[model samples]
Target: MNTVPGFRVISLPRNTTVRVHRRSATIVLTLVVLALFVLMLTVATGAYEITGNDLVATFLGGGSDMDQFIVLRQRLPRAVADLLVGAALGLSGAIFQSISRNPLGSPDVVGFATGSASGGLIVILLVGASSVASIAVGTIAGGFATALFVYLLSSGGGKVSERLILTGIAVGAMLASVNDYLITRATLDDAETAKAWQFGSLNIISWPHVIPLAVLLAVLVPLTLTMSGPMRVLEMGDDSAHALGVEVGKTRVWLLCAGVALAAAAVATSGPIGFLAMAAPQLARKVSRSPGISLLPSMAMGALLLGAGDPLAARALSPFQIPVGLVTAALGGLYLLWILTWRKG
Candidate 1:
């Protein structure tokens, strides 16, 4: 019934009110538009170019056979995978940062991404499982196991945020070594396959890869969004959140599970693409100028970052292609330097 300067409040049937920040909404919309533009560019600018008209026509089932095959059968799946995986990483990063109350509280920074990779490697190299379903299972199992280990290790200390970060980093380092050992122990062919996967590429993506991820995100994204308010309340501290009727321990556990699942899904799909998880939430926060993490904005920013990065990875070297993960890692390193310098300044 009332409107504020920077937010719009809507009255609900049960005497409840929802306040939406105007600027955050604007920024989310802008990011979404940019993501769409990047998607179009990605589909249009490959070895066989598809003009704007042809791209639209292909989508509408009206393009020539060659155009349709290029757009529908080839590029669209990769673009969709980039978008979906980026969203997963972004949402996962936002959840972790919120839980740890640290900018660096990301799965990639912690141990979960490495754990997922370790799981996939064990299946691929040791058990010799080659199916996508099997790899996804391994990654999820590895991620959950790592999360449990980190939480148990960190539970003793009252400062969970600090302990979680430190434990995760240490665990991640060990897991990286294990992954390397696994690769080396395997046959040359298996090692080569694992190495390429570890670097993370969208080149091998297709509808089969995209469908399962899309379905999982369809369930997880909405579920995560519903917990956004409770997550923010938890950030206020245990005593305060308890006073506000939030079950601190239970909420934290559920949140961590969701976060780990999201990160694992991205890894299962794209082999631990780095920095997108760590950077998307922080970038979204800065752009929206919001004090707390906003899930929608983070997801939008993640999609936009990967969407933009995919084209560059494919076209930056003309004939030669770089894995999307390497590009993100390079950019993420630069982002870290800027953040450190900006803080000191």
Candidate 2:
């Protein structure tokens, strides 16, 4: 086999070959290391202040009980959840952006996140459901339903990307109104809870929140990685992908399902953390300089962004804390403006 200068190729027993991009791989590794550093910092910088030594000792099962509880029971779960949820959003963003061939094609930008939020609000405000599992189901259902609606609306025009995005924005606006109405109709306590969830906080995260999202990602991430090749192929347009023996329709459906599920899982866990999904893949692509959205790097970038944001949100105000979602939204808003102006130029 001929060698590519920037990619390393590995041969399998059955004569299969895998090519890995060196730069992308390096970027992913760097992002992962940074993510781990952020995770440790998150676990350490809190009211209790577990030093690096204490953190290592606690994880190794040698720290005092108070240190263990503060680290393990309280901070660790939130930190882990931040990483897992961020990875899910990042990967989901990559899938959507690649599929649509548009950098603005993230789940949040196209309304899936809002749809998921709508579902969760329904469960929380109308049905009075309090469990994470129930909300997760609602969010997933809502995401899939919204995807279907947008696809059907976009299919008629033969401009799926443009129509899908526009339709999603419209639908998302309507849903936002609905979400607000539901909150108004709800009791004060329920409204407050729903409002807080909408703002997206990591404060209440526990093992229960972390475990399910981690398990879901364990399945979804591998499935997404497997589909990455087909996803990249589909980027060359459906005609090319079809000529190459790819099942264009089937592949698209599966990709959309996986993307929606990832986004929904993140929303379920973190109440639709804003802009991480949209920003992570684009940032990853810029840093890696990959021709298209790279899944692993995007996932790593997402984890790093969220992991870093959480600590800032927690400590930025000292006595008062901001939601991580707000931080991402502020940053993401600036990024959006910059990208738009830069692209125009």
| Model 2 lDDT tens row, 243-296 | 999998889889989999999999999898988888899899988988889999
lDDT of each: 0.89, 0.88
* CA lDDT, candidate 1, residue 311: 75
Compare the candidates by TM-score and give the number of the best one: 2
TM-scores across all candidates? 0.95, 0.96
Per-residue lDDT over 132-160 for candidate 1, one digit per residue giving the tens place of the 0 to 100 score: 89889999999999999989998863778
Deviation from native of the Cα of residue 118 in model 1, angstroms: 0.8
In model 2, the clashing pairs are: none
Model 1 Cα shift for residue 120 (angstroms): 1.0
Worst 10 residues of 2 by lDDT: 155-164
Worst 10 residues of 1 by lDDT: 1-10
